[model samples]
Target: MKEDIENTSDSLKETRNVFIGAKVTPTQKEHIKSLAGQCGMTVSDYILSRAYNFKPKARLTKEEAALLQNLDDCRSDLVKYISALHGMSTKQRMVMFN
Candidate 1:
């Protein structure tokens, strides 16, 4: 009977809620609940939305930011090298990257 009801609902494109269990610290639970309340969503809804559209938060430490800046400099240097050798044949470009 439950399966028949589920099939009928699926045919109608109606949705039902599903639940899963997760373990987290009390503080984490409180935070999620607070944020979800602000958006008028349940914690589960907020978490599912976040999982579906994950965007990384900026978490750069000072040292990590400096390292990224150094890598950016290296990327700029490589671009300049490639442009300077515009007339170098494809083979030369491949060799330069290698």
Candidate 2:
């Protein structure tokens, strides 16, 4: 179908599926990892962002970091609750709503 073909093309555009490998000294690897940590990104993500000419933002403050962690926990809890809802019968769901 044309729709299926278009969907595949759109998905391909959305993802970077290419792999780039490099050789680096242990010290260099550590430095790159440290920089990535400061940007709150994985080493690979940091490298890719830099390669694409994107500037990495400064690290978050302790309070900001704590808030982000709490937000992540809340998001996880919400996902679990939604998944549980999917297993409920219609009557049970109506009971829940009421």
Candidate 3:
């Protein structure tokens, strides 16, 4: 519907222009470049699209939203575990490991 499309469009704010550096192996860069070309999006756009899974016109049902939230929480837990194993302080570490 037109109203849904308009609402979706309004929700997405324009990305700010900023510089962020990433260190990637040559192979990774080449793969990203090739995929970006195939998808007809710039390398940055392609990467961003995959990372955000952005679709201007797509909508999430309530069940999908709940699943997404659960996945996000799992990701957070994984990050905490990785951090604890690396160098994060014991005090800041989560008790889930216990």
- Highest TM-score among the candidates is held by which one? 2
* TM-score per candidate, chains pooled: 0.38, 0.47, 0.40
Q: Which regions of candidate 2 deviate over 4 angstroms?
A: 1-13, 63-98
Per-residue CA lDDT of model 2 for 11-71, tens digit only, reads: 8886657789999999999999999999899999899778757899969989998999999
lDDT of each: 0.77, 0.89, 0.73
How far is each candidate from the true structure, as Cα RMSD in Å?
A: 9.4, 12.6, 17.4
Preferred candidate (TM-score higher): 1 or 2: 2
Ranking by TM-score: 2, 3, 1
Candidate 3 residue spans exceeding 4 A from truth: 1-15, 54-98
Q: Look at candidate 3 and tell me the lDDT of residue 36.
A: 77
Q: If both were scored by lDDT, which would come out higher, candidate 1 or candidate 3?
A: 1
Clash pairs, model 3 backbone? none
Which ten residues in a row are the worst by lDDT in model 1?
52-61
Task: Give the lDDT of residue 48 in candidate 2.
Answer: 76
